[model samples]
Target: MSNDTFTSWENLVKKQLKTDDINAVLRKENLEGIDVKPFYTDVQQPLVNLPKIEESTHLVAKYHESLEEDVFAFLLNENVENLEQKTIFVNNVDLAGHISPKEEVQYFSLIDVFDEKNATVNDQLVKELLAKQFKRNICIDIALHQNSGASISQQLGIALAKAKELTEIYGTEILEKLIFKLAVGGNYFFEMAKIRAFKILFNQLSKEFNLNLTPYIFAETSLRNKSVSDSENNLIRSTLELAAAMIGGADAVYSNNYQIGNSTDNSEEISFKQQIVLAYESIINVFEDASNGSYYVEDITKQIAEKSWTYFVETEENGGYLELLKQGNIQKDIFDHAIEEQKWVEEGKIKLIGVNLYPKLEVKKSVEELYNNTEIKPVRWAEMFE
Candidate 1:
């Protein structure tokens, strides 16, 4: 529609709502403070011309030593082809004894040295590891950011800052095999735009260093919105989250178990099957850029990128990510947001089904303890309500 036609429609909306400001009646604010209008004609500003992303996402499953063969057997039984192409995220680095010689699966190690969930960074350990020129993927796991209640822009900015700090400490060689593990939340469109926006911001950061780097983003479902009592609803939540990750153009996707804390026996298989159904049956992986021409998503992506870039710049000026973490700035911001969101849930402002609204009579409270004395901690929002 033309700008003139848009103005006419705005006038009609204003009259219907009986308000002078059309935005006041129709616009909504997202968690990142971005304005979500009811409709869009065209993008006001195009930030970055996004390149064509891959049509298919690589499936990533957690590796267990005992159930290694069983996992493969299950996949094969389900007609999952190309076993070699699948990625395995394992906590153990010593895969020599575990994996079969015939299998050619890729492994993403979760070494504590690089994991943000480890809380404190052992500088000497990191230097020692980097000196050996770690060949495996050096994960910058900002997935904890979302699980800790960080906003979308916060995640992007923090990821960029973390990458910058690592490059400065360990040199640019680390960027070659760096993997960004992000947590995909339940907000369908916003979560999709978050991944797209991060790519733009990361590219901009790379340009500042005179290097062209394509990020390998591994998207997983967030634990923040998951509830122990209402575990059944978690399945539906994770499916949408996985869909968001694939549509957002993640290099890899891992759907976490819907059952909270090993409550169900086949939770791992259930999670893996979620990916299988989305990839094969639903055929969501067919599109190169599913949300490419979407005006709403495009606008949200640009806004996130711009805001995140500004946050990154400010962060760099203030001694980067680690320095801020040591000063408790990063942790404080995330903790404050976490508390605020929990309060919203408590007051019934945020309707997390089966938590604040329509809760079960015999719901069990989460054993996941809250940490008040940590740097940047992981938290679940439903913990408060339960």
Candidate 2:
């Protein structure tokens, strides 16, 4: 439709609708506390300019000159011999500590295992794998549960610090060649902003370390907001959440399908296909960085970057990300945020669809059952580490 035609239609709708009453609908708040406005005009826009399409050189500079030797150099130069030639073992910690040869797994995730005792082991395993493996990616969740109110700054700092340490231990050149995956949460705009900001931050860090590699982002739907009572609705929520991830330029995304509150079969084909359909059927990737030019998105991206930068500087002042984490400062912040969130739910300030506001009927799947049934295991070193 032409701009004038769209504007006329909007005007007609505005005239027919009671402008005053429109506030009631627009002012409605979502679970995330994002306020909706009855109307938006260019006049109410923030004075922020759209984020500049960062120079392509900024990205090109992150990779080694050798990796850019050909059109498919990145893929061809990735050491696949290391991945296929390695033998991995799986040690079942939950069971009688039985060890089995590691079979190739389709997906992997890295989470809370950053103690001094384990850090060395983790680093060794990562180094070994990178030397041998070709097509594998490392999933790292340094930001998970670190703080409240979307601490992207802290997350980025922690991630970069870890990456730095890894590079020092296992040649910066190889570390640059590896992909680092991250976990993303439910704060739609904030999460999207975090990923975009991270790309810039990672590029900056790579330059400082003289490591050339573009950071790869893999986003998963957050587990924190999944509801057990009305679990099906979680699918709809994830659809929107994943859309934000795609718009933010995530290379890969996984939408959680199991009932957050109850345990179901892990092999849910339908849930996996949701992402497939989105990528292939919907063809969302056709328009690269679709949100790049949006006024609101650009504004939010800058806000996220500024907020994250402040947090990162604070982390440095506190002797860096790992130092604060070891002191439990990170945990304290997350606990505080959780407490505030719980209070908001109790006070009816945040209306979770099936939990806080419109509760479900006598549901078969309860939240407790979901947590109890799913045995979440950390990514095993033997599985991916050579």
Candidate 2: regions farther than 4 A off:
1-113, 116-121, 146-150, 168-171, 261-267, 360-386
lDDT of 1 by residue, 1-386 (tens): 98899889888888889999876667665557887888887876654445433346766565534445534322121222345544455444343224342335554534434544443565764554444322345677888888988888888999998888878877777776577889999889999899889888877778778887667777889998898777878999999999998888887788778898874547887887788899889887666567887899998888888888888888899988877887778887777676676666566766678877885223234323553534466777677655
> Which regions of candidate 1 are displaced past 4 Å?
3-22, 45-55, 63-86, 93-105, 115-136, 360-374
TM-score each candidate.
0.82, 0.63
Cα lDDT of all candidates, in order?
0.71, 0.48
Q: What shift in Å separates residue 300 of candidate 1 from its native position after superposition?
A: 0.7
Best by TM-score: 1
For model 1 the local lDDT of residue 52 reads 31
Compared with the true structure, what per-residue lDDT tens digits does model 2 show for residues 1-386? 56897678666766787563546544655333333344444333343222222211011111123323321211111222323222221111121122121355121223222453223335545543444333433445543443232345556666666666555556566444444445566567667766777776677677877754467665666655555556676777666667666767766555556464454444244455455566566666344465665555555566655655566667667766566656756555544444455455445565456665565223333323222111222211011111
Give the TM-score comparing model 2 with the true structure, all chains together: 0.63
Weakest 10 consecutive residues of candidate 2 by summed lDDT: 54-63
Residue-level error in angstroms, candidate 2, position 321: 2.1
Please give the RMSD to the true structure for each candidate, in Å. 4.9, 10.5
